[model samples]
Target chain A: MWDYSETVKEHFYNPKNAGAVAEANAVGDVGSISCGDALRLTLKVDADTEIILDAGFQTFGCGSAIASSSALTEMVKGKTLDQALEISNQDIADFLDGLPPEKMHCSVMGREALQAAVADYRGEEWVDDHEEGALVCKCFAIDDVMIRDTIKANNLTTVEEVTNYTKAGGGCSSCHEGIENILAEELAARGETFTPGAVGKKEGFVNLAEKEAAPAKLTGVKRILKIQEILEGLRPALQADGGDVELMDVEGKNIYVKLVGACSGCQMAAMTLGGVQQKMIEELGEFVKVIPESERPVEIAGA
Target chain B: MADIYLDNNATTMCDPEVVAAVQPYFSEQFGNPSSLHNFGNKVGFAIKKARKSIQTILGAEHDSEIIFTSCGSESDSTAILSALKAQPERKEIITTVVEHPAVLTLCEFLETEGYTVHYLKVDNKGRLDLDEYASLLTDQVAVVSVMWANNETGTIFPVEQMAEMADAKGVMFHTDAVQAVGKIPMNLADSKIHMLSLSGHKLHAPKGVGVLYLRRGVRFRPLLRGGHQERGRRAGTENTIGIVGLGKACDLALEHMEYENTEVAKLRDRLQEGILAAVPHSFVTGDPDNRLPNTCNIAFEYIEGEAILLLMNKQGIAASSGSACTSGSLEPSHVMKAMGIPYTAAHGTVRFSLSRYTTPEEIERVIEAVPPIVEQLRKLSPYWGDGGPIENPEEAFAPVYA
Candidate 1:
């Protein structure tokens, strides 16, 4: 069983604002039954001041999902459309003390439903469909834009974290590579490195507000030095495993490397290469493709 | 207010008598059965008695057929691996899609190792297609492993007839009878089944002990190779206490088999009928006429299962669900999905498996407790009542699996 907080259990057992809002003018629906969770938020707004007079919700999901939706409803009442829009998925989870990482998608669903409702109130067009960006996870219908946005919002660095936050790559696992690429791009844009398995050690939220204002692009010599530093950091660990790596060349986004010693003909060579690539992308805070020296194209190899 | 446990299909409370039978072995009779001393001789005789009890319950030809293992999963693993090793030429295996994870997971891993596995499908009522089973058997098939009874739906498969069919094809047949062993009667002496597996905890014995009934003349290969235990069929020191507990459980099960079919089944029927009567859009999800006597799986549409379970838990009622949310996965129970149960009902399936210890009063309390819970959750469901948010209700909620 999940280690659910007492507050979550409280909201689950006796949820607040658990019906459609009477005399409601705005309604927003997100998620689908096929996805195993869905939420519909209804709001009664004071037409003049645009204050949410009442907020109610109906959810079809697990205990955490219902609790998240309930907490969202309680948090949004009496707030203006702008103030309500400012409430992130993290705030909803905080209202319930905290949710399991796997159930973080419940809070995301709550946030999406709030956005949909507010957009409905303003008569703005809002599409819950994945048409706005390239679809990444076909199983959950999550798109690349959503995955990137979620990564930025949650400081997600791994495919598993992205799945916990957005339900992408949670099924079939065919789209994990796509999610990883999006995470790399998002991390690059933010000038933040992706650290494999760093989420477990990281605690509390990095002030998301502070993070939003501080991204600076790294380029040219600084970028190359960063890549070399990451490779240098990785050398000791590989050497300990009776394997070693040599930096052969760097061409724009591609970093070519030669595996020496036991690493070259090892059965786990691909996994070792993937780890090297992941570490490079994370440390450099940008997208950098890792190519084995043997797999380098004829033109690149000659150059 | 005592906690009402209706999750017997998952595990059972150890019977007091069985516990008493186990206690003496832990302290007084802690001899190595392999030793030749008088202490070892006494412990070895107790083990013999335990084996005889199991052999009698299964109606096997000899007590030598009973091989004690750690748990049902181990027994299942040993049986399947043994069949493949004994017939190395056959590369294919036939099993049902709705089997316990013990069998299904092993088969999935076997598939990765280049074994051809044919997963037979089940109908909406969770019944197997016999014609499909007969057609799937071929000379290349090593063994056919199907559960005697499904753990999720309590739907019993006709394993005896299926065993005969496999025997005709010169193929081995094994049944994971973990759920069916204590609940139903089985006389393997007249059957062609080469192997059967049963867990101790599923029938009021303590956990950690299980039995694998291997037919007397079957060629076998040991999964664990060390210490010549069970005449070199299995290895490792015996789980003496657990074996004694399981032996007592089987002996008691034989005594209470009639009561299980009559009294426990009546309580089950009362709970099923009461819940269906109290809630609308509710239906049962197994082969009603041909299921285990004490198991009932009901689905309450529109609402999800975890919510209902949480509420029921608040009232000191314990049960299990086939809903995706309850399972750590994103999809509902594979058993429910394979039976073509629609998403509308699949996400809300609840299983209540009773034991011989259940009372009519407890059944009445559950019957009273469930309706209000379902009513409360359905009111919170977006799909409930005149279809609140869905634009095209019929099309949106149409059966996906069917």
Candidate 2:
């Protein structure tokens, strides 16, 4: 559970200006359901002064998110559009006596919504550099620009903290390597290379996330064709060992294989299974699991 | 303030009787179970008696099979790594995609160590594909560890059947029954489960105490190497008080098992049904018939789970979620993701787990409080439409010139 500050809890419990502004000139909605947090900021601005006469927010997120939205509305109520644009996510966190690092992304949502709302007030588009940035975290629709900005703002060196701050690399973590690369690039620009310390090296997250995130929807003839190609590559070595491996059937994404001759009873057969599966994943975009026929796990005598 | 707690799956409050049972150990009975004196002997005896109670509940062949550990994660690690060490020749593991981090994270680490892990997928209702499971069990597989019941959805796995299949194939079978031991019945004596892990806190005992039930005569390797404690199966002096509390908790759970499955289950169904009837665009997750009696995981579209939970908290209602925002991870639950739950619904999924202590009044309070909360959050949601959630959350990436 999050160690939410008292101020955050207070604002979340009794959020002020939580409803949408009716007949509002400016409306800004940012984030997506996929990200698990979204905010819509509605501002009733004085047209001549460009002052935010009133601010309202409707947020779909956690406590930190509601608190951030509530705090953001309070922060921008009396500020001009230009002044409102200067309110960073950090300012929202500060207002709430600081949010848990993991909930910083909630504050980030508030800032983005505010920016979008301001852009709407000016009758202009959110012209964020995110438009040009590559999509690094597809699970959350987070772009490279979002990652870079959060990293620079928080002086973040670890992927975990980056996820906390920006929600990039938070889902399906297949983008961990991508996040690591961006973190390094951002740090390098600041003349600060991440000192790969205990925490950084301990998780070794890149391989696992990348591997687990393998495409999960390959099927039909395409799946069979890919599995067959992988089997062909693995055939020669098995043949040399007086053993042969063949793809027998494809059920959904599961590839049924039969090991003929020596390979059927070989001690290193598990290694072969791993090899076949790994090769299939590497070549076929990782949607198939190789299930060998005519094999049962080693039986043990019950005590 | 009237508080209602329905997140028992996350952690249960210690039963007063169990707390009383452990109180003495913190003060007067502070002697080490490893000490030679009379005081120590008394503590050791209590620990032994607690083990017997748990053994009785689990229906294990012997009390000796129970080895106390610090937490469920330690027990899981001990069971898995020990199997790998015992069968160094077999380098593969078969598990489910919906396993808790205790198993999944360890399996991920095992992958880096050159171990092959087959994560069996679950269907939309969170039921494991047993045919896929059976196919993955091979001579090269070291062990198959699946959860007795999924914590997020309370969906029970066919552990008894799965264990038998693994046992027939000469593979070790382990089950992380942390969420199942107290919520469901078990008769390990008639089953083929080689090892099982249970957490103290999940069953109304205090945290920091867990159990690893290793079938007697199974190949074993100690995870922690230190003083000859837990018969050398685990190192470090025993957490005597916690063990006693756990034993007492098991006894309490056994005593209340009927109540848990009857009245508490009725309350859960009522809450689930009430919310579903009142709240629009909501549906339950998991196989309804096969789920644990005290658990109901429901997904409310458009509104984020964290936001709903926060509002509930304001109303003094405590619950949990499989939502990405609540997990401190940008991605929603791995369980939901594995089940192929749509993004709009998955983001709003909340888990309400009842306990034997839950009351009908509390259930009524939650039912009354939830509908309005969901309706309120949905009003603010950008995705909520006249019918349900809007499909496209955002437009595809496009350049925005300043």
Candidate 3:
């Protein structure tokens, strides 16, 4: 449900190097104090040849952490120190098919620890966190300028949308609410009106994301006969109630709608959601289960 | 989606029989249980019958001991508050470390209000350290309330012996039997415990109703003050539907009481064994013995519990996890932590609790679904390879061929 990249699902369902090694040459441990992922890796190296015969990992973390650990153990074994250094975080992520940009950091940790162990083996003071730092991923990495640009380009729609599109503050979350403040600052600089919801969970995160991502395209709908037409026609009515309805993609009978502004906090939102919107949507010939778009699947962070 | 109900420890399905019992109150026979007229008398008879039925279950000495409450939380608050009220001058109470939040947080609140509360520690197996508990008990202690069994781990505490200790000193004893009632054999008359709380929802009864057992002559004050209901011991309009459902649930439980321990235990043990055998790095948490007949807490080392629950949910298997969200702190289960379970295993704790409804087929589905998920998560771990990414999955899979 967490918009996991199919790659994460694959790795999670088939993690490698699960058990403890019979004997390990070097064991490395690393984790973040903020995120609750703590990892302990074991290595079994042939003493005479100084080549890793077998390696295993034991992690106390999430899917990405476990898969990254398992994937890395298989990547580096039997390789010489120099060859192992060539294996980057990107390479580790790619090996597991690919990690969600938010979860790329888990793979990065695997890369760093792997490189660090190799460094320790070669008697070099190298840390792996720095290996993939140069790669400027506009979507995931923390390069302030890229973030500012992404937020600016996405428009002053909603803070929640910026998170979905750009993966800002997605990794090692503790910065998401802070990311919203940063968005507000950027909007203020541009002389754009940016007011966050006064209270309650975001009126609707899924629609907020859909709205931001499909800004230009949402207006120019090719098919006018579907539920989208009802959403477009009913927008003015919802606005009159001090609320706005945003369409979250309709896949058959399940129509997701977000209640913005005063409508979100209104006790009548549930009835309006089911009775008004659901009935109208059904009249448009769809079995309407008007789920609150905010409550729908918008990956906040790892559970 | 298949929304199978399996988290009995969390809450159970409202039994159809219990639902039928309360249907009359919701529809035709609706009336207050305390009116002077025939309608009131009829409802009052229903309330009394429900109380007597629960009394028989607890083997209570007095039917007056069973007081219907709003829920388990209210029952807990009433018990602790009564202990404090009895000895307003004294400011000490004692409880175990793993008591449910209903009891634990109330003790915390009491401690904040100048009440000296002693928390009895538990060992690695979640067994109560009675010596540590005894050391804290003194004449100044007004009461001692420990849970009969923990909610997350299903580790049964030695409350009966602890009750005897409290009784010797004229101190009151209470137990939050929220998770233990149907699973364990609890008889208040035979035991030294004076007060016990059981939420209807924990059994097959509906929510909004609970019972607090007060031994005869135990001094206490009403928590809710209003018109006289519950003999003025608790003063609120009786939750008529809830009372009826709870009464019926107690009757069904009594009928099925003989096989509850053995049948539920067998299913739980099957689940525990199958999970351990299937998953490579996973092992069961809590003591193998001295555990609940229907609960197994297993730590699938290196993964988050919430993620596992989400995954299990996708597979249509309902279960519980002792994750960071459950604890107010970002840390894992406090019970698991008190047992000295390392953070590695602690984060991955999942509780597969069974009931009379559980079957071996469900256990088989769990075993089939879990291992591959664990294996998959491990493949993505940063700890897997120290030097770089893993390349040779075939060689890794070679052992399977062998």
Candidate 4:
């Protein structure tokens, strides 16, 4: 189903360096069977030259994983340990022409295995275990540090892209918020604004265009329900701030809300209303104004 | 050499007879069945015949009970949602965890909409716990939707008995019979299932056509509402070509049912036995004695499924896998996971579904092709060592972070 390149197919069908290097002194293992993909890279390194004389791999995963492992083995041979360490996941993907975005994690596995193997040869402590970083995706055992690093390396802007590259947020998707936070932080570090729903345009999986095109045309009851749902989502945030909002009425693009609890007449009520309006527009994919119940026109207010 | 397709559970090649039967409706009988003219009447009559064919296959009392829809998903959605609407007071639903996404996803959405859903679990053999099913049926339960057979494992559920249980509780019972319809025999007239869904494509008909068999007296609400089509039970113009194709597929299926159980099953057993004999550490992954004759799911320890599938693809063999890699998910199939299959075997699960058209020679090809692929992948698997699959595989392959 994945649109794998012919080169990838070729590498998978006739994997160049499968199995372990017979007289290998350095070895590295990344991923696990439970993760759905694992790779063990064995390298025969020349002690004097610090060069990899031979490289071989055994992978337990998909076609792309096998192909990536084969490609990684071929790419590392005859290269210095430093040079082999320079091969990024993208480089492995490039060697195979390209891997589907969903299978990009396969290349990442290859890169990690290479790094582990190099570290093993150098006798440096390599940590592929989960103890080093804060775990973000409990389902896939992906961590925040790994997510941030992957985002930086791959220029990933969306949670879906991060998942493709790192297998985070791909399981139950409960960690998408964590991944988004990490993405936002990385993007902010790069001086880029994190745009929500941008994944809809890039992946085209969600129909943001349809929602954005006709949010105003949603029928009365449906629009009311949508607004109520959005308000419910915002309720916890408002309540956390010792304030609350109630939907008073919805007329056209105007949303009438009553700021209750500690927010009724606060100095930041205007800012709060502005924030609420912004969230509504983002979530509803429509332009709308949030009006305080006190500001409601006399005629409609009485009615 | 031609490609040998063993992925019938995913989809099937359209039979020649089905294609021929569908051809005329695309051109000569292109008139809308709703129009008031001879052309419309001819198409309408053809649709009636198609409905009757489905009725006969399902052994339903009336042809009107067969409501044609777009696909199996639509039929499933219609039945579940309609049951809820008809019994608005009942806010509970009971279903199995191993249902196709068509049912599972809908039930999940319903959960968010304030409906209490009890997901029944399956055993290691993929068999439902009847005692649990019996206990889950309560007065507040609106519907119990369970699949007749699992798509991944082809493990047939005792739906008739389950339906009888639900029916006694005044609850609607629906079965997604998409996989079970053509391969297994069922007489709905003697059953208590209020609704059943079957996709045309699964039975060798064209896609975009399915049937929702609503028993004569079951209360109903339409999922799609517009034109007074499908006698107001369903909306939109009829899929005439697809309906005719489905009708013919049903006729052909009725004729080949015996062969599917006997000859096709023989090929399936041969393939299963051959692959198991050839490949060590491989085992079947379903209720062996109670599965569809056309389906066999095997798991090769220490190797991943996509690798095996790709290697098989090189040899012009087609199959399906429950591997997380193949599913585009990070976890193996929910079916395998629910069955508590060890990760060592779950990641390597492959499903080979045959049809009545399958031959022993093709089965022989698969048998010969699969062993080497498994052997090849196992050799590449880190868990597979010099002797064979490593002992303590579960501890070696357990979730590292967990």
* Total clashing pairs for each candidate: 2, 4, 36, 0
Q: Report the error of model 4 at residue A134, Å.
A: 17
Inter-residue clash pairs, candidate 2: A61-B307, A297-B169, A298-B170, A299-B170
- lDDT of candidate 2 over A186-222, digit per residue (tens): 8889898865454443222333334456566665777
Ranking by DockQ: 4, 1, 2, 3
DockQ, prediction 3: 0.08
Residues B188-260, model 4: lDDT tens digits: 9999999999999998999999999999999999998899999998989898989999999999999998999
Put down candidate 3 lDDT per residue, B99-128, tens digits, no spaces: 888988788877757998888888888887
Worst 10 residues of 2 chain A by lDDT: A200-209
Tell me which of candidates 1 and 3 scores higher on TM-score: 1
Off by over 4 Å in 2: A1-7, A44-54, A77-80, A121-124, A130-303, B385-402
State how far residue B61 of model 2 sits from its true place (Å). 0.8
Please give the lDDT score at residue A208 for candidate 3.
43
Clashing residue pairs in candidate 1, if any? Answer: A193-A282, A194-A282
lDDT of 2 by residue, B318-348 (tens): 9998887776676889998999998778888
DockQ in order: 0.23, 0.23, 0.08, 0.29
> Worst 10-residue stretch by lDDT in candidate 1 chain B?
B393-402
Q: How much lDDT does each candidate structure score? A: 0.85, 0.83, 0.72, 0.86
Residue-pair clashes, model 1: 2
| Tens digit of per-residue lDDT, candidate 1, span B234-267 | 8999999999899999999999999999999989
**Per-prediction TM-score of chain B?**
0.97, 0.96, 0.93, 0.98
TM-score of each: 0.77, 0.74, 0.63, 0.77
Instruction: Give the number of the best model, judged by lDDT.
Output: 4
The DockQ-derived docking category for candidate 3 is incorrect
Candidate 4's C-alpha runs over 4 A off are A129-303, B394-402
